[model samples]
Target: MDMKFKRNFCIVAHIDHGKSTLSDRLIQKSNIIDERKMKNQILDNMDIERERGITIKSQAVTIPYHAKDGNDYELNFVDTPGHVDFSYEVSRAIASCEGALLLIDASQGVESQTVSNMYMALEQDLTIVPVINKIDLPSADIPAVREQITNELGLDDSQTQLVSAKTGEGVDGLLEAVVNYFPAPQGDVDAPAQALIFDCHYDPYRGVVVHVRVKNGRIKTGGIIRMMSSGIDYKVEQIGIFKIDYEPTGCLEAGDVGYIIAGIKTVSDVRVGDTITNADNPAAEPLAGFKEVKPVVYSSIYPMDSNDYEELKSSLEKLKLNDASLVYEKDNSIALGNGFRCGFLGLLHLEIIQERLERDYDQAIIFTAPSVRYRVHLTDGSETFVDNPAEYPQGRIQSAEEPYIKASIITPATYLGSLMELCKMKRGEQTNMTYLDEKRVELTYEMPLAEVLFDFYDKLKSFSRGYASFDYEVIGYRPTQLVKVDILLNSKPVDALSFLSFKDNATDRARKVCERLKDEISRQQFKVAIQGAIGGQIIARETVSAVRKDVLAKCYGGDITRKRKLLEKQKEGKKRMKMFGDVELPQSAFLAVLKDNEAD
Candidate 1:
């Protein structure tokens, strides 16, 4: 393929703004897949993505389009995730492309994430094509969305493409516009081979399937390739492009996006942002790959069965190959046994990983309560960071700080007051408020990441009646009154159930955990005491009463002294049982503490 006729771009949009749908339409129009075999969200191969109606990973495809200018063009585009949690994926997609289709819902207009994604594309200096999607909807306001594109996004309205991805209306024109509007990918085909690894997945039989965007030179079948970061060499077994399914091309030249199979067995040998270059004629410097992804939320994952620890480890390694943002290290808990302390971009990211492990990897896992990293200053004038409750410093005497984020939320003007109140309740400080238009408003707040780690997003949606959109960026840490709240069952602290909470809400949080545990734990032969405590002070307590055995039932006609003696013996036996008996904490009990009490 000629480099001048090749166009590499990606679709960037907010969640539910029709990126995947638009990709499906392009694929259908390109005639890549047979009509009978085509499906909705064809680019999203993961079952979780289909079930959740969201794209978790970025997918690339090659579209062969014959433009109106009497020229054949090869359009390669990546369909990226819109959720704030997967912004890293979007960044990688943007890096691999020279242009971006910024899709906006016609009815929703400009949203928080929409603006965020546009800025991301702008940062990469990509040619952005503003796209107003869902124009076929009865509620679609094309003119209003056009105004947003001009005023809010500072994009020319005349350049915006209005289309309905669902109805496939004006899609042909959109494809033509992509060819004419976006510039051709620029790279030296004769230079040393340097392909940026945007993604990869493990195939049991073929080994690691590395997704690459060739920047310079060409990669041929059965050629030696080396990972710039790891300095490991492998033989490229095959090269192919994605047309929903892998289509072998034998060779991939510069300015192309495709996959490479090198029979690489180790998961860690290939990294998502590493550069792949020809070993025989290597590039002097690796391509500027990608920024390191930092995880804002942390949790401990343990196998339900202790023996599945190795399985869990292998699953995580394989999962990490696909999800580079997920970071984990060996972690263990006294109550939960062996586990891994994993870091995620957000709560949704955490949930997705948990689900993928269970569904794709067939590993049953337990996740502890999610937490944000906290900076602790000890009395000895030393500093340390804590993400896991068990690792919280016991002798902290000086001060502590928690990570904070600048949150941007867009919603209808009518819900501004309620959303503001919600943020206030979360200990958020109003940073800025702007009226995007007469009907919609954008609110910015500075709040602790720990506050949003739980049900903040859920509450925001509920408070706005699902009209709100949110995006956030970490804004460093602020001094806070932090306390480690521990949940104790029968006077024994469960390390997995411990969590850090703000001092003001620690009592309420502790009380909720105790109440939740009370409902989850079954009645035992002896009284089970569930207590939430900080240091020596007990903040909240719940007691699960013992299941009584009626000793007096057998003495209905007995004398009062005999009945009294039987009752006294029963009381004595109960005391002994309380002293020796153990309170078994069910899996549900651990999950119960993880749930937000107020979210109900």
Candidate 2:
């Protein structure tokens, strides 16, 4: 196979913009998968992905297409997740490709994620073939969408392709454009083996399978390869490309996109975005743009049952291999028992991981409310990071800084005022606002990450009537009046229910949390007092009345004096219960703050 005949490209789009569907059509047209067996989102093999109609993982496949120009081309298509939470996955996938298929919905036009991904592709210096999909829909306004793409992405009219991925309309022309416009992979074949690992996952039998794009030389079976990042060596057990599933190929050469099986036992050794080179003739320098990903949100995940702790640890380790972005540490809460503090890129990332742990690993988990990492500066001129509110320092004298983000929202002009007000309430400072045209606008704001972490997105959707799309990037930390508000039940602090909040909003936040907990927690035999306090001073309080049952029900037919005596004994028992009884908080009580706080 000649390098000139190979083309590597990735598909970038907003969620449900038809990237996966378009890829399926390409595979069908290329005959990579049997036409009769072709299905929508064929690249999304996971049952969860298929059911949700979203691509959760970055997947890749190779197709051999005989173009009308009388030449056979090997096309490598890297399919990426479209959600903002998985933007890192998209970026890593793009780093392995030479071109990108920028897909947009004909009806929705350009979205926030579409703009974000397009800029990312431009940053990678990849040739982009702009595309508009779903033209078959009745709501399709091709001209309007084309104008949006041109106005927002700055792409010329001639560079765009219109197609319907569902019905295969204009797909042939798009494929022709892909082969004609995209450049062939370029590298020296004689150079030492230097492959960039874009993705990897733990295979129970194979140990670890790494997805790589051969940059300079060739990799073959039975050869020694070393990871440049970790300085670990492994014997190449097999090399292959995705043809519906893994099909072992003896060797993968320069410009080739495929997988390497090295029987790797340790997950930490095979890091994604690492360079792999021949151990005998190692490359002097690794590929550029390799950096560790920092988590944006943190949460505590405990098993529903304490007996599943060991199994839960094993499940997390296994899940971590597939998702390197997941970071965890040993965490224990007095109210919730032992658990692991987990970090994620966003709420969706957290949800996907939790879902996978429960469904795939069959481990029921109790998830605490999500939080952002806070940087605390003390009076002693020292600094520390805080992720769990339970671990917040008792005396924070100097200042407290929290992570801030640069957020972008693309929407229609009708909701601009409401959106602006909403952002202001979230302590947002206006950064930039550009009008795409007379009808649509793109607004940018600098807001605290914690404000956006919770109900922001849901509220944005509600306010904009589902027309607004949002994307955000961390913009470092900013100092604020932050305080850790603790929830106490009967004067005993519940670690799982604690949270860091602004001092101005702390009282109101504590009040809501106590109210929510009151509804979630069951009543006890003794009066249960729910108090929210900052340090020793109480800020808010709610009390649940003791369960009062008729102790004299059994003595209904007895004399009045006998009933009075029974009541006296029952009253004494209640007092004893109040003195020694412990309130058993349900798992739901720990997460009550995250719910029923739309206005927060």
Best of the candidates, TM-score:
1
lDDT of 1 by residue, 557-583 (tens): 957999999889988999999999988
For model 2, the local distance difference test gives 0.89
Candidate 2, position 462, lDDT: 96
Regions of model 1 farther than 4 Å from truth: 556-562, 595-600
**Cα lDDT for residue 50, candidate 1:** 97
How well does each candidate superpose onto the true structure, as a TM-score?
A: 0.98, 0.95
lDDT of 1: 0.91
Q: Could you tell me how far off, in angstroms, the CA of residue 269 lies in candidate 2 after the best superposition? A: 1.7
Q: Residue 268 CA error for candidate 1 (Å)?
A: 0.2
Among all windows of 10 consecutive residues in model 2, the one with the lowest summed lDDT is 590-599
**Cα lDDT for residue 575, candidate 1:** 94
Spell out the clash pairs found in candidate 2.
none
Estimate, for each residue in 439-512, the C-alpha lDDT of model 2 and write its tens digit: 88999999999888778998899999999999999999999898888889999988888888878889988898
